[model samples]
Target chain A: MCELMALSANVPTDIRFSFSGLCPRGGVTGPHRDGFGICFYEHGGLREFKDYLPSCQSAIAEFLKSYAIRSKTILSHIRQANVGGVSLENTHPFQRELWGKVWTFAHNGQMPIEQVPQPSYYQPVGTTDSEKIFCWILSELRSAFNADVCISQVSAYLHSLCNRLNALGINNILLSDGDAIFAFCSTKLHWVARKAPFGEAQLRDCDLSIDFASVNSDDHVSVVIATEPLTKNEQWLAMKSGEGRMFVNGESSWHDFGPEIIHKKSEPTKIAS
Target chain B: MCELMALSANVPTDIRFSFSGLCPRGGVTGPHRDGFGICFYEHGGLREFKDYLPSCQSAIAEFLKSYAIRSKTILSHIRQANVGGVSLENTHPFQRELWGKVWTFAHNGQMPIEQVPQPSYYQPVGTTDSEKIFCWILSELRSAFNADVCISQVSAYLHSLCNRLNALGINNILLSDGDAIFAFCSTKLHWVARKAPFGEAQLRDCDLSIDFASVNSDDHVSVVIATEPLTKNEQWLAMKSGEGRMFVNGESSWHDFGPEIIHKKSEPTKIAS
Candidate 1:
């Protein structure tokens, strides 16, 4: 499988320490050596870099080690290659523009690719099922509303889309539009929040630790979500098999993905050979 | 050159529409067809996929058209291979674990491979300077904290390390440890935020437009950052050269990378090629 990492904080913070422990799994301390990428939001836009190289050996990854790009919200990934070929075009953290804002995305599961109705305004660039899914959703949103939909309406639209995605199978995913973070879980997902009573954390894959108290003030609150627990001593809350949650400014905005209906009655559809 | 996309919203929103426009540039609409990868954060962890084919024609990107893996904070990237060989092992969006959190990263620029210091706790699995930089940074954090430093201290320590990295050549980067997003500007970086008075935006590279009023709420604040402006008629802020900034929950926290110091005053100090 693949691994994911994200940060949503009330204040901007650096991720170098945490990344130090997680990157080794990609063909080093572990086995997720397919590819990787990361995204950071700044001044209202997203800045990102991606590569088809293993995180353990990528020059970009090394630069990130010391680069220290900081954002209030961040998303990152390391690939293990279960589906697509390993090429630069297949790297994680894919991006697109809609409604004037840039949207960034990455995924960690394999889905049976299915042919779907193409959207009038959006189309896929790659053959990955993940990008196709994102495009379809955006098209749906554009068609559903004009340039005046309310926030509640937008949320409802997304809620319906999440339901549709879960129906597709193995729909664990993360998305952001530089305002909030939305996390939907079809399988494995976990999260933790660090606030006033912050403590030290230890890495599970590597010999490393950090004391959050030293970097955060009393007003700072931070939350983290990942595919696997990155530390040995921290309590990570695993999402139920089918649960979609939203985090805004380091707080959880719980949105039930609702009951999952397995499509055992329908024949599995395939897209790519 | 590669293209990057991200979303940080108050709710779960699919970037498929925006990404659809960006994907074409991968090879179909533009030129960055080397490879593609994307990661989505669901619940507390991440799910990701990568392909070693051009995003323009890759089945993986095609599948993403309909997949709606949503997150409040998302990061996505498309590659154009500036360094390392074009194999799956060299794709972007690398992931690792540290202090109990998964850290994800990706890069867009090339770095001199010989400038990096050899790492002890983390090491590169690929031959790219990106991965090497990632390992070196992680190792430094591990060494500085020794698995028992406070998180605040860890952040402070990272700030110092980031200062060192900013001194390196052209270090435009994004980083996250699952708490906050960190962004650094070296050469090219631009951003824009969409809020209350949101309006229509058109893609600079494609014939796509989205009226923000239809998809966003007044309460919904978003920020978009990129190496280049993605849209026309929007106020895109150019990051000051050689400066690093951080964003937390759609807000920016500016930090000076400190005074610039020349890496090599002469030739003898430079590592032999």
Candidate 2:
């Protein structure tokens, strides 16, 4: 298993502070020393930085922390190898082009190696179950929809797919396609939304604090999702098992509970927050 | 105008030395202080490092120069930014996924932006004439052939397209599909192969010397291509106008000179060195 982190914001936001808390887990606070990667989405373009070295000791990771690349959406992961060797090719936060837009995926759990789906359109370049599953999910979406499909409709289909995979084992995942971020929780996933009247937040992994009120405007709304919550002061929402949520514009657009997603009379339950 | 550099090796080779020589030119030796990027092909996967910051001032660039990531092929560029603004999206060496394989492209020189063909499948995420031309070329190839076509046949078609674009402006380009690298020279390009009996080579842009004979095996054949030779001592093969060459396994697989390339010939002029 590995760890996942993601960010979705109404405005372009810096991820350095949150990332600083997570980097230590790669080799210091945790034993996930295989590899790590981070993907940033800006204006329909994707920039990624991946390294085979543990983030705790990686200069690439060090450079990235201070570089402060701002983006509306970001996905990051730290891997502890199970199905693949420690190599750049096997690094996490894999991405592929889909629907004329870049789509990125990161996983934090392991399933049966033999149960990995046979890929069709997108193939895994690295020998990782995470990458293979990512290819499988994207291939399924490619076959189902064209380039201009609605996000909610795509999420509807993806909800089913995420549930099917989660049934096999722990399937905590972070997926994004520039427009929105979809997070599904199987075993461990947490989220926190920072909005108007923001206050200071303290890091749980290290001795650090961020005064969000001094940096962000009142209109700025940001949501961060991770395998484990990075901050201790904030009230992080612990996702229930089999829960899949879709976030757009820094707010929850839809929340579904696997089979328990209440099918209302005319429309599906979409609780806006 | 911009600078381009690429490498294709029979075995995985470190690119730090050549990249170090090219990086300083972005600001110190040259006035191309817009942006820089480097692409590496390793085990069917692509690892790219790009920054909108000038390479001379970029910490990311400095780290990459000493990191010494090894790969079989690489493509890099430092932009002077005539066609587009200096932004992350406008950085050179753009990549797209096609046929389950990642394809990367980098271009030098400028052209009339309006003349760039309308894209079909691939679209330019950044507003640049170079990226527009790359999209056009790939879209043309996507319509022309399927996923698993012969390399020679694909090179033949690409030869015509490269020449067509070259007729418009100085369209020097480096293209790769992980397996082979295609280099086309419209204004200027050069290449050199280092194999058995290799000797010492000194950097042209910096005061760095490398003794390839001590580092590489006798059987290793590596080819380096650039806008101009990176090393001072290398006898670089200066490419002629409209000359397109396909390199596979670190050797010239097919060489074409636009109109001089015969259409009816059953065999191509493949020069093995």
Best by TM-score: 2
**Candidate 1 C-alpha lDDT tens digits along B127-174:** 666666677777787677644443333554555565566555445566
Question: Mind giving the per-residue lDDT tens digits that candidate 1 earns over A78-147?
Answer: 8887655675445566655444344566676666656443545455544567766666776687678764
Q: What lDDT would each prediction earn against the true structure?
A: 0.66, 0.83
Clashes of 2: 0
**Model 2 lDDT vs. the true structure?**
0.83
What would the per-residue lDDT of candidate 2 be over residues B160-220, giving only the tens digit for each residue? 8887776566678999988889998887899998888989999999999999998999999
Assess the local accuracy of residue A81 in candidate 2 as a C-alpha lDDT between 0 and 100.
90
Ten contiguous residues with the weakest lDDT in model 2 chain B: B264-273
